[model samples]
Target: MAIDLYALPVTQVSGVKGKKPEELLALGITSVGQLLDYYPFRYEDYTLRDLTQVKDGDKITVQGTIAGVPQVQMYGRTKSRMTCKIVVDSLFITAVWFNRHFLRDKLTAGAEIVLTGKWDQKRLHLTISETEFPGQGKSQTGTLQPVYSITGALTQKWMRQTMKQALLQFGELIPEVLPAELLTRYDLLPRKKAMALLHAPGSLEQGQQARRRMVYEELFLFQLKMQAYRALNHDRADGVAHPVDLPAVRAFVRALPFTLTASQKQVLAEILHDLQQPHCMNRLLQGDVGAGKTVVAASALFAVVKSGYQGALMVPTEILAEQHKRSLDRLFEPYGIQTALLTGSLTDRQRRDLLASLQMGLIDVVVGTHALIQEDVYFRQLGLVVTDEQHRFGVNQRSILRRKGMNPDVLTMTATPIPRTLAITAFGDMDVSTLRELPKGRKPIQTYAVTPAMLERVLGFIRREVSAGRQAYVICPLIEESEKLDVQNAIDVHAQLQFAFPEYRVGLLHGRMTASEKDEIMRQFSSNEVQVLVSTTVIEVGVDVPNSTLMVVYDADRFGLSQLHQLRGRVGRGEHQSYCILIADPKNEVGKERMKAMTDTNDGFEIARRDLELRGPGDFFGTKQSGLPEFRVADMVTDFETMEQARDDAAELVRRPDFWTGASYASLRQFLQRENIFTGDLLD
Candidate 1:
């Protein structure tokens, strides 16, 4: 069947009016085919009719009449309620209406209609004011109805009507993208038939099958697209191969002030192998907070520089860029390697000078945000591109930078730990390196979760830390509770802390503040000018201060387990004994569970596994950043077995590259392109 793409209407439902076929088509509702596919936002079940199944106190749907007049009464000044006696067959029940004046007229005495609502079995009362139509159906066996996405102006009734019309007109117009043989083999429903049953299933079993087939197709097509994307990347681009110089790297390592941990050395070897490979490198470097990822990144930078090629380290924030520049400059300046920082906040002269230096190849290492990849900032001999946090960069932007010249090797660094199983599925195209150990002599942060009642003791601990010449961070649960609710805001907390500790310098930082203002506050804190930094979670990922040893997180029960762990990691970086005090309300069990997870272990990997187990796959440590193919039905946490099967299926498909060719591949490719999974430019 040929699809009349031109005949199909694509009008917004808001402005829809009179149902003239021509007017409907003019508004882009050309045919019944388009109308039937108009899905609903939700379904209301009024199907059940048996009143005996409903207990005396149970709320239910029943067909009855207004046997007696409604008794009305007023409540306070504005509210009123009316209760009417109703009966269905031999069963008697009472129905009540609240603030329903017009209902008195709408429901008259001796009227026969179906009422949809709940009943109070013990009270022998029912709330029968839901609907007048007998639209709900009863299941011989219990089943659930499905709801589709919708806009405010379009209702379930409108959708059902449009769908009915579309089925009458253009139900046969939609062409099947899946091959006939595949459909039969998979026992999948045809597109038109599926739409018919999806809107109006004959049985609960049919609905289940329909949902399973649709969800499978969605997930399978997604996998198919991701495979095609990987294929395009594999077929076209050639990676720059710059093998590690072990002897020179060893010499540099020996000259460092601290010894490298076994974990760090192992990760370096994995990265070195990728750098030496012929394929363009796409690798993720995951380390716990303060696990020394910067040092590992520096080593890769050194390797890039030693190979006579320029390297760039792109961070997500300006403060992080400055921190990286200051730290890298100190380490590399001794080796005569020049490092330059470029951020949006830089003055015109500074930016121009930096760009010129980069163009001239005078700056061997460049560190900045998206500013580094802007078209004007060209590298003379770009070889390596290291992104500090993978989540901040999109695939398109990263690909554009890789296209800059010579297809520079890409390495992405993240502080979020991911389990090995998911890493294989989500980042199948990339290698992985993990630094699971902290640097030697790093103090273990002593963690505790306390209630607000222990405020004085907490204040005394802070005073002791401050009097010892160290600084602390006091973070609120939110930036502003005024905009939201039930969360501690940083602004209010800052004001309260200012009054409580008048002698201490308390500075505020949050998303609401200007970038320059945030930078100034951060600089002051770093320079010890501010003894207390009161802020939101904006400081979770990037900010690094060794001197700040204490972290007091308010409403700690409100944050995620991984987030709580990350916040706790902000401390215990320096030699001094650091502490993280979690101020949580005792009544919150959910919050207590999360806080307990932190006090139990500092291992990010274990915490991540437990988080996945507790919250399910959707809330895993770094699943949001993992970029896994979006699955509507497959729960990564609960459907681990199915996920494993999907991964295996994807791998098998990749191995047989020619299996998805001809018209089959054309449809798959179109689907992928529509979903923005694969770009048309294979080389890019």
Candidate 2:
């Protein structure tokens, strides 16, 4: 039967058809095409070994046949050993398999075997440590062996055979996404041939080149999608031209308790320019935590209100929304612009009153969480919409907020700073404004890495800080005890801390708590009633508590550098000296490097760069697609050059009429259509 690689699911393949392959699905192998694309995690070198080239103490693999029956012998004690003579060309070497009496039975005369072990040149013997049977053929016969990542339920042989069969069956039918001319110009392998070579490459370099071809396709398609999304959204949405309220904005800025840094001033100026434009403002405002993003939002809100249009500030967490609401209300009160809070934690009466005021335009600015996305929530004139922690929200959520008003201006903010190269690749469609400078007099958090033995000292330090009338936070990687992870969890840690520190008030926070419960816990922590708060990474965003000066993160290696930076920023909010203790003993080099990078510098961009280098883009970017498509093969970190090239190529390609109307470009067009990027006039 002929099978189209794109149309045939992996379950239809032989060896997998009758096996209920949920295990393969768990590894993200769902189709014939995907299975072929599932590249090997590693390759084992199987270069042919020459007996004459063997050196003392060198470990190598040598294939040979048993020249004589293996002899069983006992040592001075009860230990049994099997000794055999193997012949390779003119040399006959002694092979010893200790505590392996079965070898005497299996190693029959003239039977071929491949043994890999350390050689004892003085004794002329090869220790038979690893064995390869006849079925495990070419892997030991001087060739590279591909090792794929799989669950215990799936064996390496099964995975390799599955890929080989899939390639043999449907490789020729795999559809190409790129235009022929473009593929030729880049010297990329054809999609069909690339998959074939990737599954069974004659050489290591050939396999890598084939993989690079796939990476280029994935990246190029992504750039094309992003550029199309930009064309559809930005080119069509012409926003109301709100004249810059310079005097009011200046007054709001001057009213801020602390002065704005040069970087903040520059970013705000760029945002203001976007706001007054005839086109919709699709701008990303990224800054590290404590970079005064709240003040910038306040100024933007003031300007929008001064122009007689309401504003909306949506955040990921209810605590953040309420915090922004109170702070904005106080900041804008002197300017006489009313602000209201709309969140899930609000009482029915409170929400009803706020909604009424918002509808009447009495509320010039409304701060909210996902509550703003509800169908009943109406805005009188939402001219400016600012979403905090924008990455936490999906593309559809932002689209829904934009729908509440006619081409409303948007200014999304992220406290997690992303590097410039990555930001351009991810958010190339939007103008970028960055806040890099922190407010003056804010001290840097002293970061340290410690093992389990230092936990008591860290706890003592936290106790001293709490006794001195300051607050602290203990963050756990897990919300609850995970039997599989074996890491410290917030619930168990909180219980242990409460018992250990009986004199102080301790609070617990995690994602499983209800909105009201989280809000109350945050309120207690902010008020200093809960002197030491034990929580999870839910507080990784903008949780401002000046009194909280110390932070201890358990299993810090489990988190990425960007997350570690954000968690550390939770402290050092006040004038008091702050400290961040990482309770970790990383097992690998990557984990240790992450911890070292965390303790080395406090700069978020630097940490982001290091993170991109250490963990690649997927883990660095997380599920926060940031309005960009997730890539399967292309890592923006390693393929930054290719990403840049693809980005340029995509920009040029979209400008051509052929890209939209040519017959060869039909598949590309269909892909963009499915992505909802090339569609037009949705802004209206």
Candidate 3:
């Protein structure tokens, strides 16, 4: 009888007993099926190679006989090195192992073994990383060895043996999820064959083929979930059909201080069209920093208000909320649109009055931080909901705000330029509108990378800029000194700057400060009461100060490209020539690449694309904050082409008449149901 792989516990496998099951469980591997799915993160090729072809730093595997007596040397109290001479393909070479003194007894002269490590051609040496004694029945020559991420007491040898035993027992019993048509269309290996190849591929090409199939499978399933949600949202009939007064919205746009960019106008049109539809406007408005997303969002809010419905704008931070409130208040005052601000810092009585006004329809639009989603905060007729820096809020938080109204239109705005592949995967359920053009009169920020040795010069430059009646910002990665990291801290930097520029005031800001303190500090900086503001990344998204012309980031290499771009954006908002100086001494290639990318171009999209390549999707926007799905094999950067194919296929499949019920899709439906990919009435 065949075993049910998904139901069989991993402990049922040979050697996976006692604490072994618990260790595997830590990796989310509780069932035999899951254990098989735990594919190797990397592979080491142990195929025997010619000695003459090996270079000094080439990592190669060679089979040889122990040619000399092994010598063990003890240096430090707990340090030792065992060295021996090995003969491989009639060529003698030295093999060394560090802190492995026990190997001296086992590595007898004339013992036949397979060794893999970096070959030092100049010294005719092989630093032994792995050893296989042929007499002991462990020969891995001419094969690729799978390397897995293991926990306590789980070595590579044990993991490989257990996996081999599991495959022998239930490999044939593993079921296929994708239909036969897709398998033939994509030229994919069978599910069982792919699993076998992934665990123990005969060649590198076979391993790559196996990985391709798995990546496609994961991406396809993920896109299916996204497509289903999108379909469900589109099918909802309870969405508001707001009266889109184009002329009124146009007039509001015309009344703006500056003319809207062409990109902004195009996106505004898309947003207004969505407002007139019966389905809720589930759209994402993304642009580079300094792009006019707010104007477009304000226009949508105006249209909603003109239709006799209130609007709610939620921001991530109180400072940003207050800034938006002040800007919108100034813009909407002439039109008689009442706007109110609600934040956590408000007093009890103040909060009560604001809630009452919101509930009584006295406020046309409400701008606040997370306070807008409170249960007691009622909206008389909520029509549209706009969230700035949408990545800062979780899906549940956004959903709660949307639920406060009767299918209100949601417009999520972000200054971060999301890559096309990530947008399709992460924000796949929402329609995307991009504004790539900056508003007129905005100058590109001049960015430069300098070493710590040039700190004096940077300070002198900042002094000169401040002397000219302009403000400056100095950013640090940490708020206080840390034992582990040696990067500059905000508090110490603030003190140093105050001492260096004794004539000017340097205000300190960090996340640890209270809201009122931060607001006060920002107020002083905006009014030029403080000539320089020293802070952490809390100012990454703050009230814009056009007078701040110089931004000096200490240890800028410690920051991601997107973050560095955002910090640079704080400056260059005014008419004066702006500069961003990155003070860093990068130690790695990735760190150097970040600095180069920052200094190369001021385009946020290009910076974001490079950042995604450097940091990957998981760290791009933080998975929890951005709601990006985690996949085992599919990478949002390298496997983008495959993702696009999967997205197109999933979109087509979800539209089929028998997508949810047909025999061809029975396995797909069952898999999605068992995995709980589609919840509620999505599958129905």
Candidate 4:
């Protein structure tokens, strides 16, 4: 019988005792298996090199004999410097160590030593970052040394020694989680051999090979769990097969004031096709802002309601909900399709009356915020559910809304375009449909990035635009002055603009205001009562003012690329030419890149790809909200090809009848059960 390395504590290792165990625990390494799995974030090459082959300012590792006793000089209260001379290949070089007075006794005359650091060929000097005696227990001089992230007085030397001990004792006991056939098919290293190579590799190529194996393993496990969830959802028998009336739906589409774009038509066709399937529709509908997604969604709701079933549209904010309800009401008016709005701000009596109407099947469709998912809210034969701006809501919130009916068909919509790599990993379980074409006759917004020195000119442009009977919006990052950030706030900007343009009406809006107050301010802005509206990012999503042609964003460097694109989207909605002026003085390369990307093109997909590369997957959409998993060795950006292959393999394997019960799959089943991968819902 094999011992379970995962159950053995870190103390069971030879030298991981006393404070060492506590230190290891601080890094979340409680068991022997975990300690081994804590792979290095990077590696440092300490391969010994010849002095003749080294150049000036080259980082080199060399072994030599100390020519003299080291001397230590104390400076200030606790700072000290040690100097010594060493002979490498018959060339004398002075080595310096800062704040390492303890090494003075260790470096005696004629002692063999290994030093690694940058060399200054002109001065024959080396600033030593590490020192190792030639006869040390295990030398890392001629190899790639692993660099681990440490804390609590733990040194790399101690970590390497303890890891060698753990591997020597329990390496063979590391069970193989993947099947043997898979190992041979992919030409991957065995689990035990890979673990050993990760800690102590002979060369960079060897370490990369080891890392490839781990990356494939992590991605395979993630895909397997995603495929299992998809299978479970597909196998459900309680799904409602909503009716798809193409003739009626097309007629409704034809009656709209504007013609539907080719992309919108294709997406609506996909949604209608899913409605007739045996299983519920789990699909993601994504597009850039002003892509006409609402009209496509409205057509789907019309089909469900015409078939004698109800539909629900859930948004993120009350303002958005109200906007949807008003638009949906106008669209459904010709056919006498009734629509109602529900929000947290509704009165108790009004809420009770609406709930009663919905339960009694009197309401054909309802649009709401999170109020749609409350315990008291009920629906009569809800056949379709549409969530707008899907990323704003949590997974549980969406799930609760689906629970209102018998596995109703779901259509999730987002204005933020997600890259193909992220779409495959983060939303792998759902089928995706993208809308890339905007409506006809829509013009691109002219964008520019300017420094604070151009503030007066920008204000003058706004003044001219406003004097032409148009409105403008001035956006800030913060609601009030924050001690930590030096960016402009909404209140101060509003005050300044009000003073600068005494003849115009300037209004302030932020997240700190009440819903009704926000509604009133927005109402004023929409009606052109407030010509210059100074606000924060609270107006990024649903506030649409076609008359507002100018958008001036202060401290635009503080926002992400996607966010800036969204702010730029607020304008360019009307027929008149619009402009977006970005006021920023970027201090870093990434900020400069963002500014360039914004001013270069108006394609949201290109902007999204750049954002993913600059900010990485963790901050792309925010890891928690994005539903992206934290991997041990795999990176979402660099390892996207591995992820794609893993997804295909998992999909193929899950279709096998014996995958869940075969003896060859016992290890995978055990691993999944131990990790609790299947216990939770997908994308939660």
lDDT of 2 at 480: 84
Global lDDT of each candidate: 0.73, 0.83, 0.88, 0.89
Please, what is the TM-score per model? 0.80, 0.81, 0.93, 0.87
Per-residue lDDT tens digits for candidate 4, residues 33-117, read 9999999888888988998899999989999999987888999977998889999999999999999888888998998999998
Each model's Cα RMSD: 5.2, 5.5, 2.8, 3.8
Model 3 lDDT per residue over 231-327, tens place: 6557566688887888888889888898988999899989999999988888989999988888788888999999999999999998899889988
Model 4 lDDT, residue 137, Cα: 77
Candidates sorted by lDDT, descending order? Answer: 4, 3, 2, 1
TM-score of 3: 0.93
lDDT per residue as tens, model 2, 501-542: 999999999999998898899999988889999999999888
Off by over 4 Å in 4: 1-35, 48-76, 80-98, 101-129, 133-139, 148-165, 228-236, 347-363, 656-663, 669-684
Model 1 residue 679 lDDT score? 52
Which one is best on TM-score?
Answer: 3
